[model samples]
Target: MSEIKKIHMGPAKCAVDLGDGSERGEYVNQDYILNKLGRPHRAVSLMYCYYPLDETWPARARNAFKDKEITFQWDYPYDDYFTYKGGIGGTTDDEPFTCMRDVRRHGQDVILTMTIDPNVTDEHLEQIGKELSTFGRMQLRINHEATGNWFSFTKRATYQQVADFYIHAREVIKKFAPNVQTILCIGGVEHPEKGGEIEMEKEFADAVRATDIWSVDKYMALHWGWPFDVADEGGNSFGRSKVADTYNLTKLSEKRYRELCGGVKKPMVMSEFNADGDVTGPYEQAEMVKEFCDMLKNDKDQGWFNGFTFYQFRDRGRLGLEIEDPNNADCGIEQPVMQTYKEIIHDEYFYPEMKSEGDAQFPVKLRWGGSEDAEGIEIPLHFEKNPTFCEITFEDEDADLNLMMEINGKWFYKAPHAKTIDFMSAFFEKPLESEADMTLKIFAPPASGENVNDGSEDWMLNTYSTITKMPNIRIRFAPILK
Candidate 1:
């Protein structure tokens, strides 16, 4: 079998849920994401099964990303009332089959998470294993905690039972998706009843031993109507000042899991994470995102972390999605947090220019309309081809005295002994010609040191200036003395 590829650091993308029932519209379309962010995301998670609600789920997903490049992770039906009720008789058999067919047909990739509920019997899991073996591209989702009607073996059953379930799941996953791309384990939820207070570190560690990829989810109470400050309590704080919550949680979880795996050679995906309480403004939200990214980028050790996927692309009503305040028009589209994120993601810088060995100089005359007190001034300077010393001499000494030479953006005074004054000794590289219309701004600054402190004094500095599309500009290189 070919080796499984590992993902390191990169941009944090997003995963969106395309609602349920007839009202289920495209929650977050690919085009919308691309346009808003400028580039296609690395991965996107699709919630819900493709059975009845979305018979054409694969087609819709494919069309949404027809010409773009993205990784699509399908969250197969959870062992729950919503999925089981909508699916054909709550059977796991046809679900995997249909999902695989869709994956193959649509030419899309998927991270298939198997059910870990008690209702799913050993026989059912075996079937899932067989199907995974048949399916080419897939990932397994392991549950560290119970969900929906599912009960955790860690709670009621013995440790052996928990280990058995994981061993079986692993064997089956290897039989089919043997590359074992991803493994997502449940972290914790807001509510306490759903396997509340149960720590499955040992259980998760055992599972990771048999898989190549690993991840976890921290369903914060903030999304479910809890106060923002509540996160601050119990080491979970969503406050603007406590922006490290998301990063700390994910990092801590991954660190433990890596330790459990004896070295953490796998990437940690924040399977699910979203903001809660008083929907943060764009700028605040952007900072929160930056916190998550900056921590990963700055982490000196460990190479298993790939990237993060924002729990959602848009706000889902069930999650109590709230705008800061409608009347607070300032919180709208130009939200500070959103703008901040946009800037961070689209930041561009000029490429550095390569410095050559020998010195080079090129000089040319420049002219422009005079402003305020300045008038037409002539500047004559002989630049050394590669010499370490040179100076300028103008035919009209009076005109030259009334003018000054500006190199780059700094101004220099004219000396009586032009030949004695070495110009090349000051410059690091050969000076090039300034572009046209570039203002040298040959004026005078208010005298302060060594001169009278009045604007009436004449500095008489003729500044040569020009503007060009080139990266650097200089005027001392022209009129090379051969």
Candidate 2:
């Protein structure tokens, strides 16, 4: 047998767009992947169009997704672009904020596609910076695919204006949330004439200074062919360029980013990646994913590539890892690529164990149900040493959900919601000053909007009743300061 190449470098982590963050789609697919498929991706991706007029456009996105379903005047007038100063604080009412917090609580990162108008002001950037400051490390991709014809931002703003907005936004956010990495995402280099005719180097030159990562949203369209006919063309479904190399196009984009940034190296990410299933099938997509992973592992600049977020987990067509079942998104029929991808990601190179630098993460599943659960379940926490600071996180739990925790029968802590509520340090200083073992009485009260008047006494029948529904509940302890 030819010598098997020793796998050296690969993505430190991987993510997937669980699909439709605005609705229950992401939660459904996330549950399916974690509970059914058993994929251990450390991050989740979602998109947001920063339309400030409705005030509830992004906030109440969970209401509906279809354009036709929207009851309010949703579109933001391009010429009358205004600063979105709302949601500065991490309000539980904010869907995106809660989702991001939930992902972080579950020991996963978030990739937010915060599509915005190019006319954002310094004040607006500062507001966003403050909002992001409360969040953990996240990849914030603003105005993705600006060089493409799809996004509205590109149509309204010039190339230079786009670059300027990125530069300013990055500069402002860096002051507050340095952990939030601004990603300069663009289209692939396969067919420059198709949408991105402007030289990327010239286009993104000014923004490079602020960009923490370079990214390209590429699909193996050459091999699979476009799913839809090219718009403005008379039923032309063919790709614009003769070249049909997906891997080469990705490399070319990376090369351009490197050259454009004046040889300064920055981590590259495949922000949105998938192979269309119009021509072949999941097998072709599987091959594409395998080839992409192999390329990253074998490349001379191995670790230079950070990671990739799969285009989707469940969508309308075979474009996703599974064909979405309209009635039940979580119960979609798994595509062949799903199995292949699972095997690939389970490899040591692709799925490295992640740890916080200065924080120790302890995962605990707390489920309350039986009649005995009324008095609350006492869960014991064992720490190697006394933790100076601590934060408890509940995954996807309602914001108004209350959890009562009585520590050692001396200190009592009631968690109002899932957001960061620091109570452990106070308890840590009290009776458990030196003790490493502490007992916590965990119980959930009737949620905020629950119909207590029904008087069924089946209090636990609410959201937090089952472990499967709220799996990833964790307690993170920060290291003592020097």
Best lDDT goes to which candidate? Answer: 2
Error of 2 at 126 (Å): 2.3
lDDT (tens digit, per residue) of candidate 2 on 64-164: 33343322222223211122234433343455665564444333456777777676566667777766654545668888776765455776678778877
Top TM-score hit: 2
The weakest ten consecutive residues by lDDT in model 2 span: 1-10
Scored by lDDT, model 2 comes in at: 0.53
Candidate 1: tens digits of C-alpha lDDT, residues 155-249: 44455455556666566546533434546465622323443322454544466566566566543324232321233344533333354554555
Cα deviation at 246, candidate 1, in Å, is 4.0
> Could you tell me the lDDT of residue 40 within candidate 2?
33
